[model samples]
Target: MNDDLKQAAGISFIEQTTLDRATIRTAYRPDYGAAPAYKSYPDAAVLELPRAAWQLSEARIINLLQRRRSLRTFAETPVSLHQLAFVLWASQGVTALAGNHLLRTAPSAGALYPIETYVSLQRVEGQASGIYHFDTRAFQLRLVVEGDQGSGLAAAFLGQQFLGQASFCLVWTAVSRRSMGKYGDRGVRYLLLDAGHICQNALLAAEAVNLGSCPAAAFYDRELNDLLGIDGYEEIALYGAAFGAKQETTTPLAGR
Candidate 1:
């Protein structure tokens, strides 16, 4: 039978490596002090994020979905700190303490939340423009590399000018050590899936706030890693998105 023959034949090297590349990518990299499961900065000055409201808008699921669009254009207006916090929380905020792990708005394999969020703030009110690491445990922003990074990020994204014009950018990096330590090669797949969940939440949250956002994966890998100052070996930049206020030219909601 075809089923029997298929079972007898094993996966080709191409097939195997394709699925396992995520783990192999980091496995070959020289160990970088084995990143801890939960990443946070103890020394950096932290900006306390206001507790985000649960009901940011009265939008229903249908409305949020219909309004969602991958907008490239953005207004020059500065997004408020509160608005930023709400979007950040919706994306990867810690919701509950589930024993040893903290449950978030998105789920992860084996509850190993391997994705760490970093942001480049370009025009957030009352916040300096710089690279900041989100401290999910404490709900705060820890300053990492300070100063405007719009131009540099735009270059890393292959001259995607829209990135530089956005109010802020959310960079999601996968600390593979957290997942690969347990799940091995399979964990890499989990990391990619987790990023999608987090990004989608961001999109919906942006719509609720009437902000424009575009999730982007087409970027130069090493360049982006260097931009974020993370080792491309262990903590690799897997996905990201640019967010800002909506410009008049942004596409309107679907009429369906």
Candidate 2:
């Protein structure tokens, strides 16, 4: 983990690039230390989903809502590329118009939209396992991590085995500046609330597409932020939702 990479990843902790080399080396042990960036954030790129990706119907949406539940267990079924695209689109993609700005599924305080989405791909059919930034405006995923990033996700999320088995995991991060620039301390509160709204929408969107999902808040903060190349203070992990097919024997929930 070098200082140059930290800056590109939008990390805010390092004081100077030279100091980071020694700091990162000493911090390396079992769990602490900066994680290498998965990939560079590409300029805004628009993705064109096949025409068939738009074939989902309204009846399917309602059925999913009625059957909504947190699915902890997953089948070994691999999610299709189109299905992934659909949920991503439904969750935070721009759905309508509001003058010059765009509208999305979940509402935000003043529509500041402080929440950013990242995906750790594992079992999607057409995509490789890696980190990616969800470009809501372009309705596409911009690749960030270029290789299998699921293993690191499981570790960061407190050894959540289900996270690794799932086809994809969505990491919700907050860009504090977007809100804090206006609301100050209150911005912190709204930033978290906004993340919740986005996660719920993602869960519903997953159900609508016949995929299972579970929202998680338990994880190592700095570890996850580094894996996603996010600066802990400015943009950090808020929550994660694991999605995939559910296997019957995978124990949906353990007794508390």
Candidate 3:
């Protein structure tokens, strides 16, 4: 019965604007070498902690979960490039060693990796404000929308005030063909599920790094797709999250 309902509603909800009419071509290329290189072992100086302090445990994860919350207000303080990089790596960083397949903090439909991350930077210290595509395979950011496109995010979130002040906004988009080829009509559910998992990773990662954020599921899909130069139908926006320094402390992980 659920499958039948999904199929019936899919036609109206899943079908989107055609790609050819929606995508905006650009001379964008991702920069991989610009990111900081890791030496295979954690550096005490860079992490700002003792080597033993970096170890993770079930208690640590639970503590982080307890402290996690949907932080809406952010201070004007800028996030460092390292913080940005760490969050990106935690959310969708490659982890698998065999087959050279990139693993995310989330599960995917047969590991097809349909999710594409697009970033809207506003107040990062070393990075300029603009839209960037996270090249998870290479662990780098590709320039997409140039200049301070923070105002554009307001349109994406239906003029929400919280988004306007966010240091950065993460947009999750799907390459439908990647999943559709495997699951047919059922692929749509997989795409949304994968998006949720990735976003949750980001939220937790933000907490781990002392940054705060929240996922924004309600959005103007067409506007977000247009700003990111995505075709609403083929490669579409599935979810979004806003991150920055918290303005004040609140109940942790309350919104998740």
Quote the lDDT for 247 in model 3: 71
Residue-wise C-alpha lDDT for candidate 2, range 1-256, written one tens digit per residue: 2333334323332222212222544753455768787965578686867644544575676677778888888888889998888878877988789987688888999888999999888999977788899999988788898988878888887778888878999999988778766786567778779989888888988887789999998777767888998776667678899999766655567685
Judged by TM-score relative to the true structure, which candidate is superior, 1 or 3?
Answer: 3
1-256, model 3: which lDDT tens digit per residue? 1234334333235543222223424424346566556656655545555435544556778777989999888989999888888889888998775575665667787989899998889999978889999999788898988987777787667677788789998999998767866787678788889998899989998999899898997666777788989776567788898999877546568677
Report the lDDT of model 1 for residue 248: 79
Poorest 10 consecutive residues of model 1 by lDDT? Answer: 5-14
Top of the candidates by TM-score: 3
The lDDT per prediction is: 0.81, 0.79, 0.79
Ranking by lDDT: 1, 3, 2
Q: What is the lDDT of residue 104 in candidate 3?
A: 66
Please write out the lDDT profile of model 1 over residues 46-164, one tens digit for every residue: 99976444364633866889899999989889999988999999998989997898999988889999999999999999889999999988999998989999988887776788888
For model 3 the local lDDT of residue 232 reads: 62
TM-score versus the correct structure, for each prediction: 0.75, 0.72, 0.76
